[model samples]
Target chain A: MNSQLAAYATSNLWLIIIGMGIITFLIRLSMIVLLGNVKISDTVMRGLRYVPPAVLSAIIFPEMLQPAPHGVLDISLGNARLVAGLVAIATALISKNMFITIGIGIVTMWIWPFIIG
Target chain B: MEHSQSSPRREFWAGVKSEIPIAIGVFPFGLIFGSLGVLGGTPPLIVFAMSSIVFAGSAQFIGVAMINAVAPIFSIWTTTFFVNVRHVLYSATMGPKSQHLSLGWRVLLSYLLTDEAFVVTAWHYDNDNPEDLTHKHWFWLGAGLTLWVQWQISTAVGVVFGTQLPESWGLDFTLALTFIGMVFVTLKGKPMWGATLSAGAVAVAANGLPNKLGLMLAALTGIVVGMLLEGQGAQDE
Candidate 1:
């Protein structure tokens, strides 16, 4: 590890994470602590409803599409994470069960290397 | 629906029971986060501490990954803040239910709030009869504490025994799978589908960006698109 980077990480790591923790806690407390029984506006309410799908999909896409070691995109069958992710999506949609989807996805990833190799 | 005179203990246990599925799914995620944090070069003690304090799954993952990349500290904090912006919405959604509680209770619940806890608690609040909601806060406590305990145990296991575990296990991929499942579960209406697809497309297109800014960009774009579509539909109705 580069000494400069290591020192930077060691020095700033706690502050950043702790700041993040405080920020996260504040965000969670925002409406609960500040707002009192007022109804959320229609636009904001509807927008909030889409947060999970948007954020989760956003996170999942790059992780699945972008190769590790910061390599270029790999969308083909050779991308094991993408393949397992697809299977997991299918299982989730069909069964709407989290355990089954995750279980199958993990197993798929585990076996995909052998098959692709 | 008749309102039963339920005790706080009963409500608390109910919260725990309802949270079992979410807790189960979260276990592997915590383990992965702890292990990956170490593997990514963060000190094991910091990683273990993060499990309890930071507690948010995706943020910790991104934080450690950023640390590994040696990204600037400002970027790390900004990215983590973006990742957890959803909690603002959770807080809003939970606001009505929280109005009855005292400041201390509100603060505690807010600190405990996470994706899984929000979903479970929201479901309980939405479905239960209003009259029966007297002890519902206890239910929230139960669910939140259960997840907290589960997280600590799993993270400890991972930090202590993580290297001993084989790399072939492919445990890291489970985090992505978990998100995929969440996406599927949340995609109910056409607007939601539009948001998810657009977010995914944009995320892929912007994958090369530094500081994981692509994630925040995609999420914002998807929310705007979904909101517009929903507004259009409302006008036609």
Candidate 2:
């Protein structure tokens, strides 16, 4: 079992590393270059401010609540992440301090999994 | 010509000063990115260099993952191109405020632009006296420099021993957390809600799209939906 896991790790290491770097660069480069040249209206600009939070949260909440693969859809685990995330959110909104918000989030993530699992 | 002709470095520092406030939320993201890049097997030195040069967090993270996955250069380029398309909208919005500045300054700012800068700067504009982009500019410099330094330093630290870090840490989700933070800061009145809610709904529904372009498409869908709502209001009043 150990050897199998080790072998899987060794072979895929380099492939995973380079792929990550290239994709990351491409995403930001396009934004930097493109946003540099366009002409935006006030109404549109107001709208764009909201995009990151909405999309990211949409992606995150579902993933955090249930996770993936095994798909543990039970209310307890799901509720834990949901409640914890809200707590983190409130902390973030009130404090606007990264350490405090993330610290709370980490605690929630660690504890919730154990309590519910 | 006046400012650039005098001192390019001065302009650069000036830009950095004005751009600071928006950088606050972005800094931790860079720290997390650095932590993740090293943990994920990216070379330590290159991690810092990417932040200094590329200077874009989303791209750096995507690059870190794609390079390792060996998903082909073409896929990487396309995904990046589409993902960053929102900047086109962002650049357009900032144009009126930036037009008075030299082309060189415009180009420099464009390269430095990211989600945080766009959000903070976009909120504070007035059409009649547009050149007075004082606070907007400060917010960007504040935000950008803070994020830039954090990206390099944190990644370097991670590179030193990031590889040994465990998967359980899930540093990947820092991007998500950063997004949540920015969302809270940017969430305003109703028009904002329309774009966000519509975009999110589209993303969730279309999550099956290849290359995760569903999210990007959802944002595009959101822009249109937002425009329509505003248009409807114009007609109603």
Candidate 3:
């Protein structure tokens, strides 16, 4: 139940909420607000282009390689997520369609457990 | 389609139409956030408000998870901020296209900006003729608002039906799949492949790091690798 967490969330809810709102707002407004005056360097812009792939891979890799409860590393055929992720990657490469990639990925995950069992 | 370039109304609708597919893709993510928030014991009102006010999907998910873990408020703020630092890049990309806009329009557009909106608007700006950009902010507006409205609605729906989804459905994987699709579509060259693989390797290597700092390290490593590759090419030219 985490009474302390409940208390903290209840008491400071507005502050945390408003804090996140302002922080996110400012980040979104940063370069836009400074528009025309400050130019992002070409090198920096080049790096910026990698942000999506990097950030996305950072997010996705851990999900597949390290499944929760903190310590087991799963890169084997037994890891359903890893297998489904591979399937999704292939689907994405072949079709270049997000809908199909996600659809097949989900179906693979659903069916993987049954096959493994 | 051609008429949209002239009238703001038409331009706005075009943006909405362009965003429909993105919105559909985002809908489940929004629902997942709402359900995650509720399952974490956050108040429904707070979940609703945060979804509308904060409006960044991944950040909101992290914020709620942090709160549930009883993490310090400051750390929560910091994590969310870090998670959203990517928007600084998005804002920079959108700046040239939107700079001519009025203060009010800029402010509203900045507020509406999201990953989906950025993709749609970036495509429009890159593809459209330079002469047609005058009213293109309307297209940005349309796309941003479409995602905004859809996010709020989907979040509310998730909160209402929290935890009802069967565990076997593996809905969370869809988010990752969506990101994979994004990664695959955006991969145009060797530098991108290098960036993605290096990031994944670093993220896996740093899996045990606390507070998801592994993600930050991975992103930095990827950017650096990509930039180095780009620098090598630029020098040869």
lDDT of 3 by residue, A30-82 (tens): 87878767766767656766777887788788777775435478878888888
Tell me how far the alpha carbon of residue A4 in candidate 1 is from the true structure, in angstroms, after superposition: 5.8
Residue A96 accuracy (lDDT) in model 3: 80
**Colliding pairs, model 1:** none
RMSD of 2: 6.6
Per-prediction TM-score to the true structure, in the order listed:
0.82, 0.69, 0.85
When just chain B is superposed on the true chain B, each candidate scores a TM-score of: 0.78, 0.75, 0.82
Among residues 3 or more apart in sequence or in different chains, the pairs in candidate 3 whose N, CA or C atoms overlap within 3 Å are none
Models ranked on lDDT: 3, 1, 2
Using lDDT as the measure, name the better of candidate 1 and candidate 2: 1
Find the candidate with the highest TM-score and give its number.
Answer: 3
Q: For candidate 1, write residues B1-237 as lDDT tens digits.
A: 434757798879888997776687768778877788888788888888887778888788888888778788888888878778767768877786678799999999998898777766766775676446678899889999888899889998888777776665666667678767766853577787889999999999987787667877888789998998888888989
Stretches of model 1 off by over 4 angstroms after superposition: A1-17, A37-39, A67-71, B1-11, B39-43, B62-79, B127-135, B210-212, B231-237
How much lDDT does candidate 3 score? 0.81
How big is the positional error of residue A101 in model 3, measured in Å on the Cα after superposition?
A: 1.2
Better of 1 and 3 by lDDT: 3
Q: Residues B1-237, candidate 3, lDDT per residue (tens digit)?
A: 464437788779889998876677668888888898889888888888998789998899889888777788899898888788867768877776676778788889999888778766776765666456778899999999999999999999999986886655667666777778777854767788889999999999987787667877898899999988877777988
